[model samples]
Structure formats: C-alpha cells, structure tokens
Target: MFGRPQLVFLLLLLVAGLAWLRLPGDEQRVRTALIMGTLVEIRLAGDPQQFNPAIDAAFAEMSRVEKLFSSQLAESDVSQLSFSTEPFQVTEESAALLQRGRQIARQSDGAFDMSLGALKQLWGVETENPQVPSAEQLQQALAGVGPEALQIEGRTVSKSNPHLQIDLGGIAKGYAVDRALEILRRAGVTSAAVNAGGDIGLLGSREDGKPWRIGIQHPRKQDELLTTLILTDRAVVTSGDYERFFEKDGVRYHHIFDPRSGYPARDCQSVTVVAADVASADALATAAFVLGPQQGLQLLEQLPQVEGLLVAADGTLHRTSGLAALEP
Candidate 1:
C-alpha cells in the first residue's frame, strides 16, 4: 500500500530544474534496502556525513519492528499471539498499535480488521501457492475475523477466541515508515522522505520548498499514472486489488479482504488515502476499499484530516472532499 515514490522523487527534480538543483553540500542521499519484507527507500537532503548515520539508525529501528511483528520469527510475540489463550504481554509499542487498529476497526464498522489471520491464511494470497477457499472454509474463518475478539489491557493482549489470528500487515508497514522518519528528524535532517514498499511518509519538502508531487498508480494499468497529489509533511498510501491477486475461472481475487464476508473486497479496484500519518492512511485506504465508493468516500469525508480517492469496480474514480489531484 504506497504512492509511487520514485515517480515523485524524479518528477520533483525535473519539475524544479538545475537552477534550484542539488544546492551543493545539502545534496540528497538516497539509500534502499530490503527491510520489513519490502524495499525501503530513504531520501535525506543534508550533509551525507551526518544523515548517513541517521539512515543506519532508521533502518535499525525498522528492522527491529519487522522482527517484532513478523509471524515467522518464533521469538516474536505475534508468533504466539494467535494461538495463545493466556493473557499475552507484548511490547508497549505493539499494544499501542493494536489499540489504534481496534479503534479504526470500530470506526469503520469492521471495514478494516487486524484479526484476519485466519482469512488471510485460508486464501494464502502472499504465499507461493494461493487459492480460493471453499464456502464452508470461508465461513469458518469469518468467525475469527472480528476485532471485538481482541482485548488489550495495557501491554497484555488476549483474545476471547483462542483460535483468533491477528495480523497487521499494511498498518505495521506504515508504522515502521513513521518510526523511520522519527529517527531521521531527531538527527536534525532538514528534508527527507521514506518509502516503505508503497506506503510513504515525508518530513520536509524537496530543495525547492514545493510540496512533493506523488503520482497514484492507475489500478488497472501498470506503469501508468492515474493522478498526482502535491503533499508535504504528510503520508500517502494506496491499497489496490492489483497489488496482489490471483485469477481463477476469470474471477480476480485479491489480498484486501472484507471481514464481513471473508472474501476479497471487490467494491473497488483501488483506494488511496492521504493523512497526517501513514499508519492511519494505510489502514483507512483498506477500510475505504472494503466500504466501496459511496460509503467509502463518506467514511473518508467524516474523518478529520483524512482524504481518499477510490477507483470503483466499474473503473470510475471517486474522491473525498478537499483532496486536490493534478492531472496525469
């Protein structure tokens, strides 16, 4: 779930020519690495000598969060969270993120759910082999899809149903990107941007002080720009059926699921959200997609400082009030 950062980065330079270019010692330093199961590309504009260390610390924090949230790591709390019936004590960060996720779930009427491990596993969209599950299997998984089953008291998190599986795939990536920016800002970097997969967060403008121009990828067209948004000091995220999917009998199944139905959310081809923070935008993008265009745009309109653009199943585009888009 992310806006096209490379597109934004390149366009930013082209839009502002060499006259404002580089600015000498305050040159931008970009580094990309495989972290948290995605390509995390960091752009920092300042003296490389200082920002380089900040990048190290930023990636370190991201790596830490990745290991903490990854289910494959036997030592991670998430690995034990799903099946454990006992009151499990997770780190404070994990608890806080879980609570925020639950709040979003409540606000969206289960449109965005964190406790979808069962449904996700049944579909296996991200796995080497993905398949559509039987109706009976979907019904069984749907029973464990609600966030109401998750109860968090301080750092202690437990589930009413011991079999409930909790996974915060998109939201956690957003959180990691936020954490990375925090580390960069603390280092006194003047301007920077961090793109984790498709989720992106910005700390400041480019060398020209203009809002960063980010392009939204066309849901049905690869390498095509659907639209663009000018943003600064904010995060933008896109959740789309095109990100991950499988087709069977001419039916396209994607990874974004509606907990209410335990199937791929088919109301929209994609949904993009912009907010003050990436985590909220990331989760809300998925929420809006599942809610469909009408209610999805309504939910986006109701939220303060949140905006969204939804591409409907019919290839029509809908957006919330106050979202400014530049023509592609």
Candidate 2:
C-alpha cells in the first residue's frame, strides 16, 4: 500500500484548500470529508434525488476500506495480519486486494510493494525525527518484505516470515476511490468524480457534457501547475519526491520508497499515470517513480489503457506519446 497526497482539480481550480468552484442549484452537489487522512471530495451531477444517498454510500465505503486496510490502525484487518503468528482469515474483499497487491508487486518487480511496514519504521518518514537509517538498519528493514513475504489463498493470508511487516497504504486510497466510484455507478449516477487527496477516479463526464478537467501539480513548486488534463471515465494518480520529505544535507528524502532498497526512490521527481482505474494508476505512479523514466515509460507503453508522464531527477521530462493529445 502507498501513501500519497491529493490532486488539484476541476476547470483549473486549485483544490489544495478544498476550494472547488461551487455550483449553486439543484443540478450539482459536492461533499467533502476527512477520510484516510486526506480531504476527500465527491462531486456528483445528474439526478438530484440520488446525490446525497450516493455520496453517503461512497463515503461509507471509503471509511470501511480505511478501517480494514490502514497500517497505522492497531485493529485494522491488515494490521492484525501483520502481527499475527498464525494464518489470518480475512474478508473476501481483503483477499482480493491482497491478491491484487501481489499482482502489482510482481508486475513492478517489487517497486510497488505491500510489505513495507518495517521499512517505513526505519525511515521514520511520518515521524518528527526522520533520519537516514544505517546500511544495517536498511537491510534489516528489507527482511521478509515484498511480494514473497505475503501469501494469500482465497480468504486466508499468511506471512512466510514473521519479520514481514505489511502495509497497504500504497493501494488502499486508490482502491477506495475505485470502490467509491463503483458504488456511485451502481446507484445509477450519470456523472461523478471522486478526488481523494490527488488520486482521482471519474464516471461519465462533467455536468456540461465535457470531459473532466484535472491538474497535475508541479512537484518542486507545489503551488504551481504542471499541466491540465482533459479526461472522463478514467482515473489518474501522481507520486512525487516533493511530498512528505525532509531535507538533510541538501538532499530531500521523501515518503515514497523502493521496497527493494528500503530507501526513497530517486529516479523521478514526479510521475503521473492515467488509467481506467485509480488502483492501477496509483500502483503505476509509484512503480514509475522507482523504475526511473525510461523503464517506467516502457512499462506504461506495454500496458493498454495506461499513459504516464515522468519528471526525471535531472529535470528532464518524459511521457507517453499519446499523453500530448489529452492536454490543450
């Protein structure tokens, strides 16, 4: 699982403060709540009668997923599994997600990992005193972590080595976004957008029958815009070195890490991926960031319904050939 910030949004508006341009009328409804430690905003268009109920269901789903998968929570499903000595039985949904995490882990060759609990602790990225761990500590952190440490057989999951510490933060938020949109769709929503921090998923189109507009935030200059994308019925996720980092001796150590090395990935300053679902996009964003620009672009090009934009550590820009068509 990955931890990421929210994306900017809607018609070039900055969503940092949740300051979406509000539409006053019965046609559109917007709601915001703090879920998964991020300001999640849901905008719905179409039937007014279904707005509140759909938003309610979507929020409920996100909260449920967070409670089940959050690594920080002592009682979360995954957290319990992390500390369990014996095989743990989980819900069908958790099983599916764990399996999906494994698939993505293998696909990215451990770049997008679900087992980074110890690594996260070693880095202390979320704490006040985040320091660079020693080589021994980093090696210790990598013990039994990655796709191999995790085992999922239907509803049962077990750790191959007890030293494994699993964290689903990489996949949870995006999976929540996907599930939320799925709920909205099931409720017969004609058009809707779910923006969790910046990992976003869309359904149908905007109220004006135009494609939804999303902004890719500039990594170094957080306040500035990178580029705007015109999209609909898709999801986009961005992972960057600029988010959640502390500078030490002129080097910025960010939260996103390479599971293999137990260190922050340095290949790209930022990587944005667009895919049919937020889960895939989120996984790809982190993978691309770790794989570097060249290999990352190759990975994206090999996949259908996926496009990526990468800002290399050397200040070079690389992107899929088709990404230009989505911009103005």
Candidate 3:
C-alpha cells in the first residue's frame, strides 16, 4: 500500500483536476477559501466582462466578517469579547451581531444561549471521536451556560465569569450569508444566492423572474428530498444531528446541545427555519432543535415572520402550521 503522505498527495491532485473541470471556459469561475471556512464559489452567469470588481470585493468583505465572528480563532474579536472582563469593544457591524444574538436568546427563553461554549468544548463535536462527558464534567460546564451570564451593552459584551466562552459557529454562518446578500445587492447583482455550508440566503428572483427552488435534505434517506422550498428574497437555515454524529453502542450523540444539562439534545433529528433574514433563522434552528418537535412548532406559531420544519428522532417530519402558505 502507498504511504499516507502519498495517498494525500494523490487526493489533492484528483480534487484539483475536478475543480478545474468544473469551471466553465470564457467565464472565470473562482472557488477560493474564505475566512478559514468553506470554499466560496463566484460564478458569472452572463458575459464575463459584465462582472465588476465590486463582486470580488464583496467576497473579501465576507471573509473579514467571518474572522471577526469566529470563535475557533483565538485572536478573533468574538473570542476576546466573550472573555473580556471589561466591556468588550466592538465595531458597528459586530455590535449588531451581538445584539441580534441577545434578542434570539431572549425570544427562545434561554434555549439559544451564546454562552454554551464551555459545554461545547467538553463534547468536542467537530472532533473525530465525540463522547458523552461525565456528569461531573457536564455539571461544571452547565454552570457557565445561560442568558443571565451574558451582559450586552450596545456593541460591548461582558461575561459575568471567566469560564464562559462564546461560540457563534451555530449562527455565524447564516449571519454571514445575509451579510453577503447585502453586499451583492449593493453591487447591483439582482439575482443571487449565497450557500455558506448549506445555510442559504436567496437574493432577488432568478434572471427569468422565477423563484429559486431549494431542496430540503431528507433526514433518513440519503438520496431523497423531504420537500422543495420556493424562495424569493428569503433566508433558510437548517441544523440537524443527521449531518454529523458519533454512534456509540447504538446511541448517537450529535452537536446540538441542551444548555440545561450540557448534553446533546435527545430531541429532534433536524430543524429548518425560513425567515426574512438569516440571523433569526440561524438562532431559531438551534432553539427548535433543543425544544424538540412539539414545543418547537408551538414556538414557531408565536413568531409571525418565522416558519419551521422539524424532523423528529424517529424520522417523522412536522412543520409549523404556517408552512403551507410558504410552500411553492
């Protein structure tokens, strides 16, 4: 067998060839890594010359926003703000994101607390082998998670204790998608969609004035779409244990955690939110997962502009009462 380094080299060569093949001739299709996140695709639909520098500039702006919000980077503004003993200083943009985070935490009744970072570290969701933490470890982490622990004054955020770490990975991707749409709109791109790791935000109608059709991944079936959403200038965000999980002795542990117990929520398989903006959709996806199917639907009914689709642990799909109206 070939050595591990040789195997990696072969994989890189294969991926590069595939990427080159995917690009169309005459129109420069650029797929570049942005914000230490996923690969972003910038495709020119019409004549290549019609594309302006503003389009590329928008991508750069998105990368800057990602760095500001990412907790994975030890030097990120969010990391410092979350751990700051004094009031954390923030720019106008970062302040707006933190304000939105607080609004969602209040609306979700602590279900979507941003202070659940310590508990996330204990579970190691992105790690290769995720585990169930000991009850003692969980208890200590849970002590630092709650909306009451966060104090947001305008753009400044201060935690009551040093143990609290803020992880916006759950919502930042969607928020970034929305910010990208704003940039695209300002650049005179009428019809566009930003898919940041499947957190989608739709701009204006398609070139032909038709709404964009989005496929919702089936929770149990790999090749099937549960439903198709016809969106026009809306944002859709989904969170699910089905995407990533560790199965131990037939029990699966996923990333969506319950702040109360610091454990992977034993509730829904997936939750999808469609809203006017990405920030609300992002927060609602996590909140609904923690609330489970029934209470999650109930919560959606209370919000006029938000609709939800929930897949239960047993694979049954439940949608908010208002979902029918938004169906294409």
Candidate 4:
C-alpha cells in the first residue's frame, strides 16, 4: 500500500529508526513486525506485564484485519469481490471500508479511488518485477478502474463491469492501525503508538505526559526530515512518490496513480495528512497527493479537523493554514 515492496521496507526502517529519547521515568516497550506487506511497530509506555498482552492482542487484531482486506490473499474479501462478478457477501468491516472509499472518491472528485486493482496489476507496482504497460494494455486496465463501477448493497458488493477489480490499498492500513489501537486500549494500554509503515496512530501521552513527536520523512531526501509534529490521540498518514518508484529514461514512475490518466500522478512528490482518525488521514493523503499543492490545500481547507503538508514536485513544501503553525 505504501508503494513498492522495497520502498515500504525503507519507510518502515525510517520510522522505526527514529531515536526515542525517553525520560528517566519513561518505561517503553516496543515490538516490530512485517505485516500486511509493511512494517508494523507497537510502542507502549507502561509496565512490561501490562504491555505484553496488549501488544500481542494488537498484533493479532492487525493480522485478522489483513486477512480480511489484503488484496494479495486470494481468500480476502477484497479478492473475492474482485474475482467474482456476482454479488459477494462480505463482513461488516469490509462493507464499511468500501463505503468509506466511495465517500472519499466522491469527495475528492475521483482523485482517490479504491477500484484501481486492475491498473495496479497492469503496472505491477506491487510485484517484484514492475514494468510500464503498453498504451493498449493501460487503456484496457483503465477501463475497469473507477469507484462508480462498484455497487454496494448492505454487506454485499458487486462490480457493474465484470473485469473491474477492487483494491483497498489506499485506505486499509489506516483502518488496520485504528483497530490495533482499539485492541490495545481495550487491553488496558493507556499510552501506545502504532506505526504501520508510515500511517501512524497514537493514544494518550508519553510516560512523561509530553506529546509524541512524529517526524515526517523528507520527500526526496532519505536521511532528512521535512518536519516533526507534536501529536496525541491523533493520526498522521503520509503518501509519497519517493516511497516506491522506478526511473525509466529519466522519468520516475511511482505507485500513486491517477485514475484518469492511468499513470502516476505528477502533481506532488509526497503528501502527509493529519486527522482525528487514521483512515481519513491515509485516504486524504493519497487524494491530496494527486490533487497537488493548490487544489490539495483547497481540499484540506474544506475538510474540518484535517490538516495537510504537501511536498511539491520541485521539492518545495506547502502546508495547510493550521499545519504551518505547528511546524517549528
């Protein structure tokens, strides 16, 4: 979901590699795993005994969610829905995610789409061998790429076009992070942070009562940070071309695709969205990245309780009115 396989690993390493300067009284327990094709990290500031069960439960919940939504798994609901033209009954969770995807597609004017699976496969962005498809192949793939082609009734979903494929890659990670955090909270974990690839969710404060400092990766620079934000009980999700891309003939082809053009969006290098929920942050980051700076900021302005930081193709940074104030 974060782009290519290697880029996903790099982003996870960048986030997990961040140095944690804990206070004298801060006792943090951390665990890391590669799940859902990305690195998932869970950090808790509490007693070790209390953290163990919570961490274990959190990871188990993430695995369950992945099984339900991952497009890679043939048994996943998303795969079932994609492979079959008939109305496929799914879990309430999958239904809800599909509903959310449709809403965002409408809100973003199709800038964010969940039915890009065919196009993704055509481009082989998630595969070990990725290549540019021919114009005819791209056109064929694009034919089935649109949110409107999907029909959802209650917990049943079917595509109007039999060739249409659905992919929740743009939003599933955020939902997984949300569920993991919920599991931790229910397990008596008062202060915890879940960083799934780059989509992060936090609850409560650090052991010292200070806000969690999350560093945003520089769009073009692997060893640098664009900025860091103080957050508590908030979600920060970033989508960037730098995360997964390949250069061909000096042209960089990345994973974040434009539904209309059937190619990588060229507006922004990366986009970070901060919101109350991880799902919104994740989807909006991709939407804004496709929308570019001017329109992307405009979309952020229209949404309540959502702020964004966009790195343009030229490497210039732009932020929502509120996010600028949060930067140092």
What's each prediction's clash count?
Answer: 2, 11, 0, 0
lDDT of 3 at 178: 77
TM-score for each candidate, following the candidate numbering: 0.90, 0.89, 0.86, 0.90
lDDT by residue (26-127, candidate 4, tens digit) is 335778888898999988887767678788888999999999998889999999988986888999889998998898888888999998899999888667
Off by over 4 Å in 1: 1-28, 325-328
Clashing pairs in 3: none
All candidates' lDDT scores? 0.86, 0.86, 0.78, 0.87
Per-residue alpha-carbon lDDT of model 1 for 80-184, expressed as tens digits? 797688889999999999999998888898899988888899999988889999999998887756758788999999887788887888588998899999998
Error of 1 at 6 (Å): 41
Q: Pick by lDDT: which candidate is best?
A: 4
lDDT ranking, best first? 4, 1, 2, 3
Model 4 TM-score is 0.90
Better of 2 and 4 by TM-score: 4
Residue 317, model 4: Cα distance from true site in angstroms: 1.8
Candidate 2 residue-wise lDDT at 270: 95
lDDT of 3 at 50: 52
Q: With candidate 1 superimposed using the best TM-score fit, by how many Å does residue 94's alpha carbon deviate from the native?
A: 0.7
lDDT of 3 by residue, 1-328 (tens): 5579989899999998787667654235333445536655543344334554645766777787788888877778888876676777777787787678877787777788788888888888778757788999888887757777777677666778777788887778777777777887887778777777667788887656888888988877889988888888898888888776788889888888888778788889889999998878988899989988998888877898889999998888899887877787
In candidate 4, what residue range of length 10 has the lowest lDDT sum?
19-28
Candidate 4, residue 149: Cα displacement in angstroms equals 2.0
Colliding residue pairs in candidate 1: 2-198, 2-199
Better of 1 and 2 by TM-score: 1
